[model samples]
Target chain A: MSLEIRNLHARIAANGTEILRGLDLTVEAGKVHAIMGPNGSGKSTLSKVLGGHPDYEVTEGEVLLDGVNILGMEPDVRSRAGLFLAFQYPMEIPGVSNANFLRAALQARLPEGEELEATDYYARLYEKMDMLEMDRKFTARSVNDGFSGGEKKRNEILQMLMLEPRYAILDETDSGLDIDALKIVSHGVNAMRGPERGFLVITHYQRLLDYIVPDVVHVLVGGRIEHTGGKELALELEAKGYDWIKDDIAQAVSA
Target chain B: MNATIEAPIETVSEENDSLMTTGPDFASHPEAFRARQRAAWEKFVSLPMPARTDETWRFADVKSLSIAPYTRAEVVDDGDRAALLKKSIGIVETSGRMVFANDCLLARDIYNDTLRAKGVLWLPMEQAIAEQAELIEKHFMRESGVLGSAKFAALHESQVKAGTFLYVPRGVEIALPVETFHWLSGEGASVFPHTLIIAEENAKVTLVDYFQSAGDDAGFACGVNDIVVGNGARVTYVAVQDWNRKTLAFHLNNTTVARDASALALRLNLGGSRVRDEAVSRLRGPGGRSDMLSVSAAEDDQIFDQRTLQIHEAPNTSSDLLYKNSLNDKARTIFTGLIRVDEGAHKTDAYQKVRNLLLSDEAEANSAPGLEIEADDVRCTHGATSGQVDMEEIFYLQSRGIPLRLAHQLVTFGFLNEVIERLPGEPLQQKLRELLHGKLG
Candidate 1:
C-alpha cells in the first residue's frame, strides 16, 4: 500500500491564492521521503491539504491512502484511515491531560464497546515519554499547555509514536527543535522506520536531513517536485542554496 | 436555648397549607425557634421582589422569580417513597447517608457506629431539634444571606422542616464524607431542605448535598445550608443540584470561618429552569481561609444566576472564589461577585474570578466582578471573562480523529474540570463529573 497524490490542486481559503498546482507524489511503505522547499513553496499547504484541513480547499485532484480515495473523507476520518500530520505548530489544549488526550485518540480507533486497559496504556505511555526524553509528570499536565518549543515538538513525536499511523507526515518538526532535541526526535522517528510504516518529512533546513537521512529527497519549487535526488542532494542544496534551483527553473521556463 | 423556647409564636389560620406552618412539631422545645420563624415569614413578605434595575439582579429574569403557585408538598405514598430512597444513592463509600423527600425524612443509614460514639450527631433536623436542642439552636441559620437572596433565605427559614444536622466534635476526623439527598417529587411541590454543620475545634469533616427530582415534575426548592468552622477546623462542602428542567430553585449558603479554620464549598448546577444561588463566606478570625467554587452546565432555555460575597473581617485572612459556566443553546448565565476587605483587615488576600464559555451564538453570559478594599495592606483582585471555546483547541482535538460532537463535549468537560479538579475530595469530584457527563449525554 502507498499514499498517492494525483495531479493535486489546492488553494488558501482566505484569498483564494493557489498554493499547490498539479502536484503528484507517492510514498510506499518502508521508505522515508523528505520534501525540502523554501518559504512560500507550499510545503505546509501540501501537508495540511493531505490531512484534510478545512481552511485549504482542494480545487481538483485526488488523495488516496492504500488505494482508497481519501479526499472525500473528513479530517478526522482521514486521520482514522492511518494518516497522521505532525503540525508545525501544535495547538495547546488547556485542561486536557496528555495521558487522557492520548487515551481518547487511541480509544476512538477501537471498535465500539471495546475498552483499552489502563495498565497497558500507562506502560506504553511511559515508554514513549522516556524515549522522547519527556518528563513523566507530563502525563498529568495539560496537553502542550505551558510547554516550551522543544517540549511541544517532543510531544508531537510522542503522539506519532503512540498512534503508529501507516503514513506519517512530519511538517517542519525540526524548525523549533534544538540540536539535543533534534537528535532525540530523530531517534524516535528512526526507531519507527521499518517495513510496516512510511514517512514524509517536510523541512526548510538541511540540518535535519543529517540526523534522519531520507531514502529520497524531493525539492518542491512551485507546488510540484522540481527535482528528485539522493541524500547527497540535501548537502549540495544546503551548500549552494535554493537560488540555484530557482534560477534553473526560471531559465527552463524562459527557454 | 431557653430563649428560643420562650419566644411567642404566631397563629396562622391557612387551612390549605400542608406544611407545619404554625411551627415545627419540635419548636416546643425551643420557643425562640418558633418566634424566629414568625419574624422570618414577616420579613419574607415585607421584602420586595428583585427589580430589573438592581445591580445584583441585572440581566436576571426578574419576572420569573415569583413563588406564588408553589405549595408545600405532603408525604407521598409508601411505595413511591421507598423507590425514591433507593434512588438516593450518592457516593459509594460514605460514613453516613440521610434521605429526605417533600421536607420529611424518608430514611437514614449511619454506618459508622464509632462516629456515633465519638459524639458526632448525624440526624434529621427535627430529631436534632429535640435531642441536640442546644447545638441546633445555636448554629442553625446563624449567618445572614448577604449576597442578595435575603427574601428567599427568610422563606427557607420559615418553611424549613426536614434536612441534615451534622456536628463533628473537637479533634474528630471523619474518614469518609457524609451524603445527604433531598428529593423533590409531585407537581408544584415545595421543599425546604436545611443543612447546618458545625465542626468544633480542629475537627475535619465533609458533607455533600444532592438536590434532585424524582421525575420530570415541576417543583420549587428553597435550600439553606449554614457551615461553621471552629478554631483550626477544616470543612469541605459540596452541593450538587439536579432538579427537573421545569423546576425553579433557590440555594443560599453561608460559611463562617473561625481562627485558623479553612472552609471550601462547591456548587454544581446541572438542571433547572431558573436557579439562583447566593453564597457568602465570612472570614471572621485571624488565619481563616475560604475557597468558594462553582461549575455549571446550562443548555436549552435554562438560566443560572449566581451571586457571591467574600468578607475579610480579620487580618491574615484569605478567600478565593472561582465560578465557571458552559452555556449552550439559548441558555443564559449571570455572575455577580464582590470581595470586600474590612478597614482593619490588613494583609488579606482575596481573589474573585468568573469564566464563561459560550457554546452557542444565541447563548448569553453576563458577569460583574467588583472589589471593595478598605484595608491599608491587602491583595485583592476580581475579574470576569466571557469567551467561546478556543478554535485552536477544537482543531487540536479534531485533528486527533475525535468527532466534532465528542470533541466539543471533551473540551467543555475540560473547561469545567479546571474547577472540579481543584476540589479537595476525589469521590465527590468523580460523582459530579459522572453526573455532568450524564447530563451532556
Candidate 2:
C-alpha cells in the first residue's frame, strides 16, 4: 500500500499563480521518506494541496491512497479516510477546550447514533498526553491558544497519535523548536512509526534529519524531485547546499 | 389583596376600556400608596406612546406598541397554579423567595424572626406598604427611569399588583441571595412585576428576579426595578428574562450608588419575541462604583433592544458597562449606550463595551456607543465590535475531523462564556450556564 501522487499540478486559488508543476512522488507504507527543499520550493504547497485546503486548487493530479482516489474529498472526509496533515501553524481556537475539541474529533469518527465512551476516550488521551509531556491543565485550555511553538508541534503529534491515520505528513515540524523540545517531538514521532503506516516528513533544515533518519532522501526543486538517494544523500546535501542540486538539474535539462 | 385608585373619571374610563386586571379588589391597597398609583395613572394617560423618532426608541418597532389585545391576568385554576409553582423552581438555596403567577401569590419563603429582629424587612409589596410604610414611602418609585421607557414605567406603576420589597438596615449583611419569580399564564394575559431594594450604610446583599411565561401563549410584560445603595454598602441585582417566544416585554431599571458604595447588575435574555430593556446606573457619591453587564443569546426571529446609561456625578467615581450578544437564525439585537461624566467630576473612570457574535448570515446586530466627558483628568473608552466565527479556527477543528455545525457551536459558546464568567457568585453563573446551554441546544 502506498500514497502515490501522479503528475500533480496545482496553483493558488485566489491569484491563479502556479506553485506545484508536474510533481510526482510515491511514499510506501512502512518507510519514512524525507523531502528536502529550500524556501519557495513549493514543499509546503504539496502538503496543503493534498489536504484539500480551500486556498489551493489541484488542476491536474491523482492522489491514490491505497489505490482509492481521494482528490475530491473534503478535508474532514479525507481525515476520516486515514490521511492526516500535521499543520505547520496550528490555529488557536479560543473558548474551545483542548479536551473537548479532541473529543468531538474522535466522536465524529464513530458510527451513526453511537456515542463515544468518555472514560475510554480520556484514558487514551491522557496516555498520549503523557507521552508528549503535556500538563493535565492543558486539557482544559483552549486549543492552541497561547501555546508555545514547540508545544504546538508536540500537540500536533499528540493529535496524530490519537487519530491513528494510515498516512501522515509532518510539515516543518522541527522549525521554532529548541534542542530539548526537538528531541521530545522527534521521539514522539518515532514512536508512531510502524509497518502499517507511512510518513512523509518535509523540512528545510538537516538538523531534524539527524534524529529521525529518513529511509529515502528526495531533493525537491521547482516543485519536482530532482534527485533521489538513500539516507547518505542527506549528508551530501548538508555538506553541499540546495544550490548544487539546482545547478545539476539545470545542466541535465539543458543537455 | 385589595387596592384603591382615585384617579380622575376620564383616566379610569380609559383604563376600563384598555386595562384587564383592575378588579375592584385591586383598589384595596393602603390610601397613601393608592394616591401615588392614581397620580401615576393620570401621568400614564397623559403621555403618548413613544415614537421611533425618539432617540431612546431608535431601531425599536413602534408598530408593536398596541395595548388593546391584552387585559389584566386572572388567577389560574388550582391544577395550573400547582404546575406554575413547580415551574417556578429557582436556585435551590436562597435567603428568601417569593413566587407569583398571574398577579397572585402562589408561594413565599422568608428568613426566621431573627432576621426581622435584626431590622431586615423582606415582605410582599402589599404587606410592606402597611408595615414598612415609612421606608416604602421614602424609596418607592423614586425616579422615572430616563431610558425611553417612561410610558411603560407609568403603566407598571398604575397596574402593578405583583412585586417584592427588601430593606436591609445599617451594618446588616445578608450573605445569600433573595429571589423573586414572576410567571404569567393563559393566553392574552398581562403582568406588571416590580422589585424595590434599599440597602442602609455598610450593608451587603444580592437579589435576583426571574420573569418567565407558563405556556406557549401570547402575553405582555411590563416590569421595573429600583435599587438604592447607602454609604459603604454593596448591592447586586441579576435579572433573568425568559418569557415564552410569543411574549412582548419591557423592563426598566434605576440604580444609585452612594459614597464608597458599589453596585453590580447583570441581565440575561434567552426568550421572548421582542424585548426592550433599559438600565441607568448613577454614581452619585465619591468613591462609588457601578458594574453593569448583560448577555443575550437570540435565535429564530427574536429581537432584543438594549439601552443603558452610566452617569458619573461625583469625582473619583467609576462605572463600567459590558454587553455581549450572540445572534443566530435571523435573530436581531440592538445596543445603544452612553457614558456621561459631569463637569467637575474629575478622576472619573468609565468604560462601555459591546461585543456581538454573529453565527448566521441573516442575523443582524446594531451598536451605538457614545461618551460625553465634561470633566478634566478623566479616562473613558468606548468600543463596539461585530464578528463572525473565525474560519481558520473552524478549519483547525475540521482538520481534526469535527463537523462544521458542531465547530460553529463550540466557538459561539466560547464567545459567550467569557461574559458569563464575569458573574460574581458560582451558583448564579452555573444556573445561567445551564440556561444558555438549554436554549442553544
Candidate 3:
C-alpha cells in the first residue's frame, strides 16, 4: 500500500561517516511526494540508499514495501521487488541495444522455459516509445550511448514506463531537462499517476515541482526530514532558500 | 588395422625426394604427395625448436613445440564416426561441406549443383590433385610462412592429405559459403588439415574451416591454409579452432591479394591447451585490400600465441588488422602484429590494432604492435592495449537485475562481437557466435 522508511540511518562504506542520521518518510499509492533540499543535505545519498547501492551502507534502517521488509535485499532484488530507481545519471551501456536490454529485463521476470512473445513485446515497446516521444530507431540503438542530456532523462522515463514498478524513486530526473523536454517528461509521468503506483521525487531545485506538482513537499536537512507542508512549501522554499532551516536545525541540535 | 607395420619404411625416402622436386607431374600423382610428405618430415626434424630469444617466439613457451609424442592417427571406427559428424555441423545453409577425421574424409555435401556444373572446383585436396592437377599445382602453398611458423608449416605440408580445395572461375560468384570440418580422434593423435582457395578474376566466394576434437582426448593439430585472390576478386576465409582442452594446435595462414581484389580472414580460438597461430597477408597489386581479424576466448590453463604481418607491396593497396582476446582463470594470450609498407607502395594505408580484455586476476595478456614504412605519402598506424573489464560496464548490467555470471558473459560476447560483426558473411558469423556462446557456457 505504501513505501515507508522508518528511522533509516546510513553511512559511507569507505569512511563510516554517517550521512542519513535518522530519516523517516512515507509515500502512499496514487500520490507523488517531493523531497526538496539544499546542497550537502543528503538528498542523493537517500536515493542511493533506497536503491540498495553498495557504496551506501545502511547501519540501521527499516524499508517496507507493502508491509514487506526490503532492507536485506540486494539492489537487483529490490528492483524485482517492485522498487525502481531512475538514476540521476543514467548509465550508458555500449553495444546493448535498448530493445534487447529491455527485453532481457522483461524476460527475467518470466518463469523458466516460457519465452517472451516477440510481436507483443515490440508492440508494447513501440507504444511506450511513442508515449515518450522517442524515435522508433532508439530501440535498435545502443542504450543511452551518445544520447543528449534530455534524451538520457527521457530514456529513464521510458524504462520506468515499461517496467511499471509499484514504487519509483526519480532521483533528480529534472535537473538537465530543457523546457520542452521537461513538459514531455512530466506528461509521461503524469499519465502513469494512478492508484497502483507511488512516486518519490528528489530534487535540489523547485523548478521541477512547478510542472509535476506534488501533493506534499518535505524539507530534508542533514539526512532527516525537518519540515513538512503542503505544495505551497515548495514555492516558499524556492523564494526563502534553505538558510533559514539550516540555522533553525543548528540551534535545535545545540540545545 | 596395420599396427605391426614398421615406424619408418623405404617409401618415406622416395616421398622425400618427390616433394623437393616440384613439377606438373608431381602436382597430379600420389607419389608427389608422398614425396612432399617425406620432405616435410625431414624439414620438420631439422628445424630446431624456437628459442625464447627468437623475435617471432617472444613471450611464448618454446618447450610446448614437442612433436615427438604425437603420431598420425587413422580413421575412427564406425561406432564413433556418427558422433564426430554430429559435432562437425556448421552453417546450416552452406553451399557445400567436407568433414575430415584423422586426415581422412568422412562425408562430403555439395548442395549447389549449378556451381559444380559451372566449373567451380570444390573437392578434397587429394581428389583435386587428380582432377584439377594443373589448378592445384598453380596455387598450392604458393607463399612461404613469413609470420615465423616455418617449422610447423613444414610439418603440415609433410603430413597433409585431406582438406578442402576450392576454385571459383572468372565472373562466378557463389551465393553461399563452403565449410570444412577437421576433427581429431584418438589419444596423442595428430592431424594435418590444409585449405587452398583460388578465386579467379572477378570471382567471389567464402570458405570456413572448423577444427574440433572428437572427445576429451589429448591430441595435436598442425593446419595450413593458403588463399589466392585474383584481379577484381573477393574472398572471405574464417577458421574456428575448438580442439579439446588437452590438445596442442598450430595454424598457419597466408593470403595473396591481386589487383583490385580484397581478402578478409577471421580466426576464432576457443579451445586447446596451447595454440600458436601465424597469419600473413600480402597486398600484391594496386587497389588490393586485406582485413585480418581474430577473436580468442582463453580460459583455465589455455595459452594462445598469435603473430601477424600485413605487407603492402603495391601502390594504392591497404590492410587492416584487429585482434581481440578475452582471458579468464589462469589463461594467457600474446599478440604481436606488424604493418610494413614497401617502397614504391605509395598511397597505401595500413592499420594494426590489438585489444585484450582480462577477466581474471591470474590471467595475463601481452601485446606488441609495430609498423615499418618505407613508402612515401602512405598512412600507417599500429597499437596494442591490454585492460580488464570496465567496472562501470559490469555495474551497469548488474544494476538491471542481471546476475554476475550473465553480466560477464554479455560483456565478453560484446567485446568479441565487435570483430565478428565486421565479417562479411552472415551465416559464418552466426555459426561463430553460436560456437563462442557454447564455449562460454
Candidate 4:
C-alpha cells in the first residue's frame, strides 16, 4: 500500500498562483519521509492540497491513498479512506470538548447505525493521551481552546493516534514546541511507527528530522522535489542550507 | 432522563366544556389566594389582546394563537397517570421530585428527610398556599409580564393548580437538586405550571423544572418561574421546556436578588411549534448578582420569541444574560434583551449577549440587544450575534471523518452547549445534553 502522488499540480483557488507544479512523490507503507524546504517553497500548499482544503485547487494529476485516487473526494471522504492531516495550526472548536471531539471522529469511522463502545473508546483515548503526556482533565476541556502551542501539537499527535490513518501527513507538527515537548511529540510519533502505517513529516527546519529520522528525504524547491536521497540528505541540507539547492536549480535551468 | 423516542403516546379524552367561570379547586387554602386568583381572572379578561401596535408583540405570529380551543386540563386515568409518572424521570437521584400530569399531581418522591427536618419547606402549591400563605403571598406572581404575555401570565395566575413552592431556610444547603415535572396529555388541553423558590439568608439550593407532553398531542403550556434570593443566598434554577412539536408554550420568569445573593437561571426550549419566553432578573441590593441563561433548538415551523430584561438597581451588583438558539428548516427566532443600570447604581457590572445559529437558508433570526446605563462608573456591555456555522470549524470536524451532517450537528451542539455547561449540577447538564441530542436526532 502506498500514498502515491502522480505529477500532482495545484494552485491557490482565489488567486491563480500555482504552488505544486508537476510534483511527484510516493510514500509507501512502513516508511517515514521528510520534505524539507525554505519559506514559500509550497511545503504547506502540498499538505493542504493533499488534505483537500477548499482554499487550494488541484489543476491536474492525482493523489492516491492505497491506489485509490482521492483528489476528487471530499476532505471527510478522504479521511474515511484512511488519509489524515495533522494541521500546522490546530483549530480550537470552542464549545466542543476534546473527549467529545475525539469520540465524534472515531464514531464517524464506524459504519452507519453502529456506535462505538464507550468504555473501549475512553480506554483507548486515555491510553493514547497518556502517550502524549496530556492530562486527563483535557478530556473534558474544549478542544484546543486556550491550549499552549506545545499542547496543540500534542493534541494533533493525540488525534493522529486516535484516528490511526493508513497514511498520515504531519505538517510542521514540531513548530512552536520546546525541546522537551519536541522529544515527547517525536516519541509519540515513533511509538506509532509500524509496517501498517506510512507518514510524511514536512518541516522547514531540520531540527525536527533529528527526532523523526526519516527513511527518505526530499528537498522541495520551486514547486518540485529538486533532490532525493537517504536520511543523510537532511544533515547535508541542514549544513548547506536551502540556498545551495536554489542555486543548483537556478544553474541547471540556465545551463 | 429518558430519550425522546417514539414512546407510546396514550391519548386522553378531552372535555372542552370549561369556561372563564371555571376555577381551580383550591379548597383548604386561605381565601386571600382565591381572591387574588379572582383578581387575576378579571385582569386577564380586561387587558386587551396583544395587537400589532404593541411594541412587545412586534414580529410575533399573533394569528396562530387560538386560546379559545384550549380548555383547562382534566385529570387523567390511572393508566395514563402511571405512564406519565414513568416518563417523569429526569435524574436518578434527587433531593425530592413531584410529577404532575394535566395539572394534577401524579407522584411525589422525596428522598431526603433531613431537608424537612431542617425546616426546608418543599410543598405543592395547593398545600403551600395554606401552610406558607404569608411567604406565598409575598412572592407569588409578584412581577407583571412587562416583556409581553401579560394576558397569558394573568391566565396562568388564575388557572395554575399543580406547582412547586420550595424554601430553603437560613444557611441550609441542599446537596442535590429538587425536580418537578408537568406532563400535558390530552389534545387541545392547556396546563399552567408555576415554580416559586425562596432562599433564606445564606442558604443554597438548586431546583429543576421539566415541562413535557405525554404524547404527540397538541397542547398549550404557560409556565411562570419566580426565584427569591435572600442576603448571601445562592439559588440555581433550571427550566427545561420540552413541549410536543405541535404545542404552543409560554415561559415567563422573574428573579430578585438581595444583598450579596447570587441567582442563576437556565431555560432549555426543545420543542413546541410556537414558544414565547420572557425572563427578567432584578438585582435589588448591593453585591447581588444574577446570571440568566437559555438554550433553544427550533426546527421545522417552530418559532421561539424570547425577550429579557436585566435591571441593576444597586451599586456593586452585576447581571449577565446569555441566550442561544439554533434555528433550522423554516424555524424563526427573535431575541430582544435590555440591560439597564439605574442611576446611583455605581460599580454595576451588567452584560447581555444573544447568539443565534441559523442552520437553514429559510430560517430567520432577529436579534436586538440594548443597554440603558444611567450610572457613570458602571461597566455594561450588550451584543447580539446571528451567524451560520463557521465553515472552517465544520471543515476541521469533517476532515476528521465526520460527515457534513454530523459535523453541522456537532458544531450546533457545541454552540448551544456553552449555555448548558453553565449549569452547576453534572447530572442535569448531562441529561439536558442527552435530551437535546435526542431532540435533534
* Highest-scoring model, TM-score: 4
What are the per-residue Cα lDDT tens digits for candidate 2 across B1-441? 233433333544443354633432346577777777767766776787889999998888878777667777877889987887778766767787888888778888775343454888887776776677788778877886588888788778877767888889999988778888999888888898888899999998899999999999999998888899999999989999999998999999999999999999999999899999999999999999999999899999999999999999999999989899999999999999999999999999999999999989999999999999899999999999999888877777777777778778778777776677777887987787778778776
Per-model CA lDDT versus the true structure: 0.87, 0.86, 0.85, 0.87
Which lDDT value does model 4 have at B97? 91
TM-score per candidate: 0.92, 0.90, 0.90, 0.95
Better of 2 and 4 by TM-score: 4
C-alpha positional error of residue B139 in candidate 1 after TM-score superposition, expressed in Å: 2.4
- The CAPRI classification for model 2 reads as medium
DockQ of candidate model 1: 0.66
Q: For model 4, how does the per-residue alpha-carbon lDDT over B49-115 read when each residue is reduced to its tens digit?
A: 7775788877788887657677667779989987887778887778889998887778778887655
Tell me how many clashing residue pairs each candidate has.
Answer: 5, 10, 2, 0
Worst 10 residues of 2 chain A by lDDT: A92-101
Worst 10 residues of 4 chain B by lDDT: B1-10
lDDT sort, best first: 4, 1, 2, 3
Cα displacement (Å) at residue B245, model 4: 1.2
* lDDT of candidate model 3 versus the reference: 0.85
In the range A1-255, model 3's lDDT, one tens digit per residue, is 999999999999999999998999999988899999998889989988887777889999799999999988877678778888888888877656788778877776788899999999999999988988999989867778899999999998988888889999999999889999999999889988999999999998888988899989999998899999889999999999998988988999899
DockQ of each: 0.66, 0.59, 0.48, 0.77
The candidate with the higher DockQ, 1 or 3, is: 1
Q: What interface RMSD does candidate 1 have?
A: 1.2
Per residue, candidate 1 scores C-alpha lDDT tens digits across B1-441 of 113322223434242233334233334435666667778877776777788887778888998877765766757779988899889878888888898988778888886664574788888887776678688678888766667777788878876768998889999998888999899999888888989999999999989999999888889899999999999999999999999998999999889999999999999999899999999999999999999999999999999999899999999999999999999999999998889899999999999999999999999999999999999989988899999887667767777887778788888988887888888767887788789888775
- Worst ten-residue run, lDDT, model 3 chain A? A92-101
- When 1 and 3 are scored with lDDT, the better candidate is 1
